[model samples]
Target: MKRNVILLATAIAAIGSCNEADTSKTPPTNDSSQVKTSTADNKYVNQPLVTHIYTADPSAHVFNGRIYVYPSHDTATGTPENDNGDHFNMMDYHILSMDSVGGKVTDHGVALHIKDIPWAGRQLWAPDAAFANGTYYLYFPVKDKKDVFHIGVATSKTPEGPFKAEKEPIKGSYSIDPCVFKDDNGSYYMYFGGIWGGQLQRWNNNKYDSAAQLRKPAELAILPRVAKLSADMKSFAEPVKEIKIIDSTGKLYKEKDNDKRFFEASWMHKYNGKYYFSYSTGDTHNINYAIGDSPYGPFTYKGLLLAPVEGWTNHHSIIEKDGKWYLFYHDIQLSGKTHLRNVKVTELKYNADGSIQTVHSQK
Candidate 1:
């Protein structure tokens, strides 16, 4: 494992059906299109989908029978890289898609940019997309003028978007990696938060303290957060709640349990009536998942969904297409630099009993 020295870093849904055309409350977007495309180098499976640009933290979804990817657009580092992940320095987002799994992938040009976001500071990180009431919604995290990270939403009439940002960040939302999961009943829930460079630990009781540090077993590790999104999909309907990821024996993991505790990259999927919550173990360099009966979980830790790859950090999304499951994730394969990554996909198999087999993307 190419694990970076474990730094006492800061901390950091559902298979609902698509009601994508339900945009009664959302105003129509009229932004001029600047869509672009790049031919994918897909001579092999499980390879980087594109090399024209660095993409990571893939949030993959199938909309209207087409595969759509919303990922963090990584730029060449202008700042020094550190445990705080400062070099990531992302400024925009590009949407990717294809007709079929092994078919040609197209890079839909900048869907959203830092400059377009009214309250955004810089470093637009991982984003996830959802379809609701006649629109495609892009949920993302960016630092505000105060340099405090907050989640925000952008809208598009189509999946491959020239998405338009709302005037402000989602109120009361802090941290990074916003994953929206829709339940079978048509309700939308959001899961988010990250520590360290993600600035999750700096917030407490819905307030932010620039000097707040992880206080060990007292605060434990920074915990991931969840909230129910209002019908419009732009704000939280309820208060943010912390998720408890405990071991199989029902023991809640402590901060030092590095590999098993939650770090960042929150994802939720529903399978056979059970909810699967997965995440990236940042400092330890692995992707892990836990099983929960509800979207807001006290989930029981399962095992690795993916072992450490060549990259220092990885974020992923899962989709079920044609009855088969696939994992969309990123690693530092194209640039060989942690911040500059390439997104890839691989088969994800579940055991008869419902556990996922660990994937070694490097293999």
Candidate 2:
């Protein structure tokens, strides 16, 4: 929250499966070695699989029967004693993948770096990716030189890629996590928000407008947003829609301290025809989820999917692989500090009623 506060004072800050070996289009990258195949006793592996590097904001996707993860790369702040600062300092993104569920992960190296982005500053925070039109699109948020957070995109011919970033950010888009979901009908929707007062906003033409900014009845801060993406995938096709995680039966979300209202990391996936909207709470330590009938939801907040971990921050994504569901998240266990986090995955269990079971990761 401290880093987020500074981000605000500085001015605004800030998945679906497919068959194996999709042959409809060419892969984004030609690096065949990036695809990892495992012949282990079990198809599954333990949590904290990638230990050598610290990664956060894991966005997991299934492509060509493999799982590709896009995460923010975390490095020491260059200050040893206070390595664990409240602020987030990320500079690059790595695309990690595995052949299947329970397989070994192949670090695809630096897919996108801050130095390469012409408009980005040092703080390259959360990112998410999607495969469409035979291309892999990476959506990320970074603070501009003016210290305002803006969302931008990078593109690669393959999932494991040396992505080429655009010179500018998504028109009219601001704030943090940019999650793009392509529905069954081939329509694309984007969900994004975070940090300072979640006044949800939408992309209009080349700028953004929010209920709070418009003086609408919507809560000015701390609610997530959903909007339809343009056919070309560069901007919003329509006005952005706001999402309220908590119901109106109770007191206003901001008034309820322990409520599971949307805080930051907004993720959406469809299971059994039910749209699951999951996110990390305002506390940053816990992860929670809700379900709706459609993409943009009037969701009913179910409950916590993950409790607090060693790190003060937690962001995640969920996907089904080989008939099993898994939660991709991060923790500070490796560095023994909050700033440097490592990626981890745990089996996600769903009860008979289609509700997600609480995840228990090894400390």
Candidate 3:
């Protein structure tokens, strides 16, 4: 095994200062086996949901009365080429769950590993899960031998699975961070994209082929992309839409400031007839969100929901359970490297007008 150590001092210096006005939040101490609340007396569930292995890019969902978190597994070795993390080499995924809020987490290990997929490359990025027609589906992204990232689907009868991968990736879908969304009417949608000019693709034609070709490079839109999913949740539904982030005044946000705009990890949640579109910013630290009247939206940019953690990258998902909302995100505090990140959860709050309040990291 090859191990590369990125000096903590140099790594911190290169990223410059965080975009937040306050930067005093230090990485959580790895002393305890499980991430618990700050007060030892309160036995409630804490941050850093799991401790046995590194987990990042959390795609959380509620299924069968339990909160299921599908997060990309991270390790200290097997670093892939040309990736951002100094040691980001993930090969498998783990399904974590909690019976109730502030409850213990159970690790359903090895739901899908890279070696099981014939066409998948070693680099397994972010993923999301959904249940329909008595079947559970895991949507994931892996680079192929051609080095192009493609989205693939794995199916299993249960949420915790030894999932079986499709023979090939979802055609026409090529990017990282694949998130599946199921609307109230039983319609499905998948949102995906990445930094450095990655374009979001939508599913259509009972299978993803491209509702429309992505815009030309010069005309490429920086926001995340979305499309309706077919009934089976396997392919795209034609007519893709590029999601634009608009300011309060109803003007489109043009600049790529870390404070606003979608960088990657697009996720959706509906509450009280309003759609909440949340994502990680370009700085790859804070998790920000916006609100819209519909799934595909000219969303109005809301304030930051999460500030930067100890890692150089941040990816997350949002879901409401038992009348409360929670944010699942990843941080490098456990492994102490950008690539080997661990998943964490924090309480989320909303203002009276339906805008989200900024969240701080839970120790």
Give the better candidate number (2 or 3) by TM-score. 3
Tens-digit per-residue lDDT, 69-142, candidate 3: 99987765645434443245567877888775456677776788899999976578889999997999999988
| Candidate 2: worst-modelled 10 consecutive residues by lDDT | 5-14
Off by over 4 Å in 2: 1-46, 79-86, 197-221, 248-252
lDDT of 2 at 362: 37
Please, what is the whole-model Cα lDDT of each candidate in the order they appear?
0.79, 0.69, 0.69
TM-scores of the models, in the given order? 0.87, 0.79, 0.80
Most TM-score-accurate candidate: 1
Q: lDDT tens digits, residues 218-337, model 1?
A: 346667999999989999999899898988788778788888778899999999999999998788878899999988888899998877776788899999988889888876655667
Per-candidate alpha-carbon RMSD to the true structure: 8.0, 9.7, 9.4
**lDDT, candidate 3, residue 112?**
85
Clashes of each: 15, 11, 6
Candidate 1 — which residues are off by over 4 angstroms? Answer: 1-45, 217-219
lDDT of 2 at 200: 35
